[model samples]
Target: MTTDTLRASRTFSDWIPASWAYPETGATRDLRFDYMRGFVIPLLFATHFDFFSLLMFVGWERIGIVSTAEIFVILSGVVVGMVYGKKVKRDGLPATMPGLIQRSVDLYRISVVMILLVAAIRYVPWIDSTVITTFFDAPNNQTYQLYPPLDGSLSTLISKALLLQIGPHQFQVIGMYVVMFILITPLVFFMLSKQRVWLLLGISWVVYAIHYGAPFQSLRPTGAQFEYAFPIMAWQLIYVHGIVVGYYKQEVVAFFRTVWGKWLIVASVLLSLGFMFLTWNHPLPHIPQWITLNMIPAETFHYLNNEYFSKSKIGIGRLLNVVVLFISIYALLTLCWQPLNRALGWFFIPLGQASLYVFFIHVFLLLAIMNTPLPGYKDFWINTALHIGLLAVVWVMVKKEFLFRWIPH
Candidate 1:
């Protein structure tokens, strides 16, 4: 055979398609992500502890229309996009799947362990009813209960084991993350291969729209009712959106800097504030009765009207609030990150960096505090001390790498 023919016959090796490989890993570690996440951990703890505390009243949720849970979930998505998406972009599909699977497995293990730990404590005879009622108890619905009746116990355990039933106060949010990662894996790789993120986003939004109109709610072990806490189908849109932004961080940043981007940012802020005004107790003067609906009983109307702005469903108001807050923070950080970092970095950085460990430990701390005979909210000094103590312990844990080193993350 001729030399040219012989060369042609030889199969090419180590040739990766451009579509399959990225220019760089794009693995930039931004402290802002950690700081924001760290900031939310304490707020999440406080919100879960109770809704009457000073932190609850004047802090994360109170200052903004959206709850800290929105921030937490969105940040989780962005980080997942940055970390896992970068790995996929850099190394190609096959190389990234194993790590993603492993990470999901680890999260699942943590979720189950935490749920069981909380359940075990609830079973203790001396445990206070207040703690059980407040934290461990599931919402009063036929859908599911964390500590079910005696007859329902075995079924509840079975359902939880299968992840078909996740209690509200437990690690249901983490379980949703695990589910999203697993479900989105194939689509992510396919979309990356096609280089059509918009198509992926369109598909995601369709699901979100459908779910919003009529949610595909979670079922109880008995399959009798719907559970809406952090509804997965609807919330996955935010997660997927984060992944898209994280994967295309450069493009997103560039777009945001443009004139159109600035307008959108301003509009988002205005819309968010408007929605807040509509939902809050104080409505604007001179608004029509039909718009304000003064005809309905105020309390009943407030409850029903607020459903349009509900946190549990990630309603329109909450979604807008998060978007505006995120854009505002991003802009602020771009201009003043250095000074801001210097001012508040120490407080949130460590906790943010070791968020998983801090989050896991906070549950135990919450239970202990609730079980104590002290007045939880009546004594201002005691309440302040409890928060300070929890913060200090978590700070030390992160700094000392107590569970930070031990945890698989």
Candidate 2:
């Protein structure tokens, strides 16, 4: 009886809890939430994209805000199960290794397409921070610019093209995503289709605890922040959580409506609060140039670039942050407060469904506009506004245009 999407869209794909309420009247499709696998992804993307864009440009090249970009981006990718829950339906779980390998290749092609588009936009003026290529040194010399504009490196150029090289000053390391997803997804999907996922996850946590935290040293072209590759191990549990939660919506909904579930939510909240309080004052972990130690293979030019790792074991704070994010989200959803719940359901549905295209397109579109220099300061301002503005235009335009259809959710 509600006048929301269940009634608004004429033709719909069968999907979602909302659709369940109006089974005959509506259909849910790609964006439908699958409880567990579904919740955090949209939350993560909306959170990341909102924060990343609004952080404001401090210099010609860097973010004005704190550098949580690494964790945010990786979490965003893991949260992507809202989409994957739908994708795997159509694509089918590649049962055999051959099928999985083929699916990996296909996804690689998709990632490559996204990479090339972002790369082309590199020529655009204010978008990709090309000016940074001309300015700063990596080690902050308060006396001078620690990070400079490296517009002259062939290796850097090659790095961008490949999207996954262990060097400095490289950007848009999307290839790493392609690789991680391909290698990880098959097992992840297999786990999801089965009922005993908790057993596997417990083992995964132990495996992670013992190993080097996902070898996150590979993030950011070994040293440059530009090639910021997200860490898979850091958020692997989260991604698995996405799949687990989504695949068993009915059980999750029932659990949420239970007394014990309510307690779990409360416990999660307490855990989150405690974790944040303790970790807030902790310092960022500084990584010695792990690349040059030749404990790892690397570029000859790969000198030690100081990065603050957030894993407690490796001294990176991310381990704490991830725990905070996981617990807080779990508690929030389990509580089922109406208005807040409704808001997350609505926004997260769009954000989660549209995330892949949203992210890839955002980078591409912004770069296209910013990479090209405009006439004056006013014109430059307009270009920046356009960066935010054209998203609406692209969304509307994507409807009739098949090629651009990929732009919309």
Candidate 3:
């Protein structure tokens, strides 16, 4: 009954709730990034589930040119830089290569499995190929096809899947990750060690620039096969910059705390708003047009958007969108961490921590829902229920560590 004993008991009780009970991790681990990842996972799911009502809130291209994919890519780069970069410094590159190699192998293995799994579903007697085809087809007739026609020989299909030339279109991002980890990541670490950060960035920009003139046709091969959705050269720009920021996180944080850092944030906010206005009339479906500012000529708007804000190529506008928004958001989160973390952190943090697991498993859940005889996209309430249900299922799986031992996540 002593006051100290009572205080200790209260503290223990506070830790009982899931919000306060973060999983054990290294002291250096930043839960903020995990929370952001967790937040983006459901948005990604909602966007992927074609015609879901939730798209109104978090749909692709709904808010400016950026989407959850860009956030995920940048966060992935930051984490790699923070984790592997530190390891290189502590243990040297020799110790770091194995882990990077293993990560690439794991990504490749999972990607191949997903591709083969989807392709195998075609042969299942009960499952209709139409469902698979329908699922892959874009609602707006955009060529987002990831499923290849199995009309070819089985060996050829397998060969293409192994080569990462075709697969479940959802997993094309993973294939890109495999390639980056194998090739670009090590080079990033090497540059960081040698204090060649500018050189690394210069090289990344050069590669991204090459996309403008020649357009890196190899990644998006012209054929019947499923091409890579994210061209490696273009996307690497985000990931490389993420790595640089993550590796020097402390220095970066300190800089942001200074007067110059505050000015940068202010500039980022203005730039973000400017881009938002510029792309207000973007052509993507489901993007809510709250403000109608027809400032630019229609012809000029379309041409500029296609050339500068194109998502596939990580166009200049798109890159700028990612940068300004990332800075603005990161600053806001840092300023409001305590209350925001307490409010929504419980739900998202766990999901974010197990993001890869949720990501991989959701593919099956999405396939199941699409293949089943369910309510069509017309029923808004039903679609909303289904989307919420899908997120709930994955959240529970993550919290329970469902299949944690077996899955690469």
Best by TM-score: 3
Evaluated against the true structure, the overall lDDT of model 1 is 0.62
Q: Write the per-residue lDDT of candidate 3 for residues 234-344, one digit (tens) a residue.
A: 788999999999999878866865668768888998998887777665544443344336677668888988778877788788888889988876765555555678898
Per-residue CA lDDT of model 2 for 312-386, tens digit only, reads 222334444454455455444333324444665543444444444544555444334444554134343453454
Model 3 clash pairs are: none
Model 3 TM-score (2 dp):
0.85
TM for every model, in the order presented, reads 0.79, 0.53, 0.85
Structural RMSD, model 1: 11.5
lDDT of each: 0.62, 0.41, 0.73
| Tens digit per residue, CA lDDT, model 1, 1-409 | 3343222222111232222211122347767788788778768766665533445443434446766767877887788777777778788878888888787778767766765566556557887534432333233333334455434566676566556353435345666666777777557656865698888999888877776777335422223111346766677778888877777777886676566876776676676566455444323232223433244456654564466566656777577778787776655554445566778779888888877777677767767777776544566567656676778887887787776554644
Compute the lDDT of residue 297 as modeled in candidate 2: 28
Ranking by lDDT: 3, 1, 2
Off by over 4 Å in 2: 1-103, 117-163, 166-174, 191-199, 211-229, 267-351, 369-402, 405-409
